[model samples]
Target: MHSRFLRLAVAAGASLGGLAASQAATIGLMAPLSGPQALVGQDQVDGFMLALEQLGGKLGGQPASVLKEDDQLKPEIGQQIVRKFIDKDKVDAIVGLSFSNVLMGSLPRLAESGTVAIATNAGPSPLAGASCKPNVFSVAWQNDGAAEAMGKFAQDRGVKRVVLMAPNYQAGKDMLAGFKRFYKGEVVDEAYTQVNQPDYAAELAQLQSAKADAAFVFYPGGMGVNFVKQMSQAGLLPKLPLYSVFTVDGTTLPSLRDAAAGTISGAMWDAALDTPENKKFVAAFEAKYKRTPSEYAATAFDAANLLDTALRKLGGAAGDAKALAAAVKAAGSEFKSVRGPFRFNNNNLPVQNYYAFQAVKEGGKVVMKPLGTPLKEHADAYHAQCALKSLP
Candidate 1:
């Protein structure tokens, strides 16, 4: 009777272990899902969900659950959502921390709890530098990277005097700083408008009066659409030479369309990239959603792949934050990114190529044609300031 009881106990323990090993991961995905940024958030959600569906509704060969939250473009709301995910939902990981400000507001809790958070959109300068957290990873480019590319392109193209404009926010400041870093020419005027201000008449008038050879700006989502449209209406687009970053990409292209023609922008990835992985992703995305995937979508898609590879390395155990972070670092080197070349810097931000693109009429449609690569295998300016020592 004792021997029979011992055999039953051992069998029960083994079954429980198997169940634990096969447990599904839970991911909390936060984004600005309403107001001006709704489309941006939808693209992120769609891209991630598409990747999840393609991966057989599993991450790392185990079923996964994704809890979606809308930050509404507010930092306070974002922090609350993060707290709920960590405290109430007990999520294994968090993705899509929205824009830079929201991400900044939520970072303290994420760092304190050692929760592995991946920012598919925001890569704030502070996080990339001295305040870098080992558990936080940004699958997207540093906020400055694309703007730096445009600045370098403008400099190379002999655009000596330029006006700089952007929404007054963390990303806006970072974008202007990045542009100045590479462009050594004179800045005619630096104008910062309110976030989602809807109108750019005053800024456009100021820009026109500056008489700068070109204009450089960083406006994403609806701001990009509105700004570019207003610029076109003011007859400054094709005539004045506009150079921008994150202002003429897939996210705003549909709205801007021909109005954005002749605009030159810089970014890490575009649908025009001639890579097999990118082609497949773009095709699948358009087929499923009937729209071109934005850079946000591409980054979030890559985030899903990165998470899959990481969880697979840990045999689906995402509960262990330190172990999961290590796995994510290892996976970064292993996963084949949809973006041409991608790897993580020691600061856990991306090291990738930045390209210059010209939006022009091709086949009677406005397309972002690849002009050149201004920065290759580029690491962020703040990476050197990071103190995390483990990653190579």
Candidate 2:
């Protein structure tokens, strides 16, 4: 009996010791890795991995583990991945929620679980408004942010009649609505094309018939590549000032090349941003990847840094989800972001500067030239609808 009691005591002490020692942070990152937007997903992953490498394969001076899954750009698949991450893997945080639809599908579970969710890409309007969760934060811009910048740019340029186009989806609708929020001019037409549509010939024909002074679009990933190429092929670019958001960026610019020349884009961050942090990030990214980093990549990089700062504050432990979320929010104000003037709004969406970039030729090479900043320290329009008050 004495021996048995001693053994039991030893076991209890061991359990207590184990409880005292915190485990390394585990991150479950989901993205569309095998679909039309494969490049987009890969860029996000690569950017995060680069930051991890630079941080010595650790976050906040402690070891970290990353579980990457492919959503295939399907909402059901994304939901399944989220379930595995939360229920089985028991991840400390979830990152890279891909597109708006996929993010929406995973949101219910994230809210219920109280897990920290840092979206590097999608920032759906629904989540930004009344449905905002304390644990959910968008490191990227709000869904309509870039479009709104483009709208203001067009309005400033005195583009009287404009045609708008985007994929027929929640984000697409939000983008057009955001554009209209700033541009009070007449909209010749609003075209909602099928998601991932291969051709834009018919849309171009209609756009020409409308005789609009400018065209604003929101296609992303492969869709952007196809649309810009098709529009250029149809001889509608130079004749119609093409103002866009996410339609002629780094992801599509390489493929669009000279075809995308003269195209103007509005975004929160670009390689041309003249900041010390952005310059270092862009140089390191290009040296490592041998290609230009897109806004998606930049956002993911920022997400990783956000985690680094938050986790560092928590001593590399993320077991307390609410504490981690609050740490992340506080870190938002403290960390030096590659994108300028980044902070989490009351609803946890980014408040950052938005700029206009024009694709122009310089020294026989087409590059995205920084035209000017259209919006400064811009906050999304939906934060007032969120229930959460300011964090003290």
Candidate 3:
């Protein structure tokens, strides 16, 4: 983030890696800090801090200094934040973004800056395809990848005539289109609601009339919180099996409580996943944040760790953007990710397992339970479109 002054309080509580150290690595975090999406943005900041704490406040044996800023959910403002980080702040690397709309204005600048941009979330299709670059990588699943897994899972369950809904945006369309790519059943009903809309009653009624065997949605943040609540109150919560991608997550589950119970959603990782790395991460995150880690947090944690791996490889070769980019590309699998197996594809996207998790009661609290892997070691379809040469 560019607003180093505004976020002094946030950094004060975070582990200060190089406050007294001479050699320091600077990283900037840009996210929506002052808008309706602040909850998820704050989670992004917390996830990065948790990873920093685990590293003993250092990245690659050097004190890591972080600058935090809020983009206010505007693309133009996001562009300014990235330019400020690159030009004025002179960050060694950049991380933390939540939306493609915002990234669209900032990502190209990273390509030119030669700075490694490790995306914690929001892997837009263009970045994974024709616009792919060596300096850019994603620790999160591409927007379509998890949705593809969810769509396949629904088909495997023998469900037919699935209804689909998402916000009328690039990511939303990408999610639904990704689902349709793998779903074998007919999409008897499909709808795109206004972004950040408060109520989904009209959409729910249409879904009920469509008589689909199941439904999949892609609401995120506050929209997810409101949509699930409205769905439960409409009494359609029991009418048909519901499935989703990015609709029900750790960020939204607490608000959903019993409403999201029994709902199945596809994700790259869940808190209950069976992996040594995931076990440690979930335990540490819960201890630090006092809340269960969501896939969003897991990805952001992995993003920071990924930078740690690359920066560590650079060791004394700090500030060498080209060399750093190469190291970051090669160090893709250096750290054990909470998602278990994570590696960069030809387009710098992750190729990993996607799981179907069902919301269920655990000790009187709603939690996501891993059902099964819908797609194992899955790679994005756009990887082939990327013309980047293989990394050495």
What is the per-residue lDDT of model 1 for residues 157-207, given as tens digits with 9 covering 90 to 100?
Answer: 988899999999999999999999999999989989999889999889898
* Candidate 2 global lDDT: 0.83
Rank all candidate structures by their lDDT, best first, as comma-separated numbers: 1, 2, 3
Clash totals in order = 0, 0, 2
Between candidates 2 and 3, the one scoring higher on TM-score is 2
lDDT-better candidate, 1 vs 3: 1
Query: What do the candidate models score in CA lDDT, each in turn?
Result: 0.84, 0.83, 0.79
Task: Give the clash count for model 1.
Answer: 0
Itemize residue pairs with steric clashes in candidate 1: none
- Residue runs of model 1 more than 4 Å from their true location after superposition: 1-23
Q: What alpha-carbon RMSD in Å does predicted model 3 have with respect to the real structure?
A: 4.2
**Per-residue C-alpha lDDT of model 3 across residues 218-245, encoded as one tens digit per residue:** 9888888898889888888888888998
**lDDT by residue for model 2 over 1-392, one digit each (tens)?**
11110000000000112221243545556787776788888888878878878888677666654667788888898888888777866666788888898889989999999988889888889999989999999998899899999999999999899999999988898899999999999999999999889988888889989989999999999999998888888888879999999888878888888999999999999999999999999999999999999988898888888888998897766678888889989999988899889889999999999999999977877899999998999999999999987767
Candidate no. 2 TM-score: 0.93
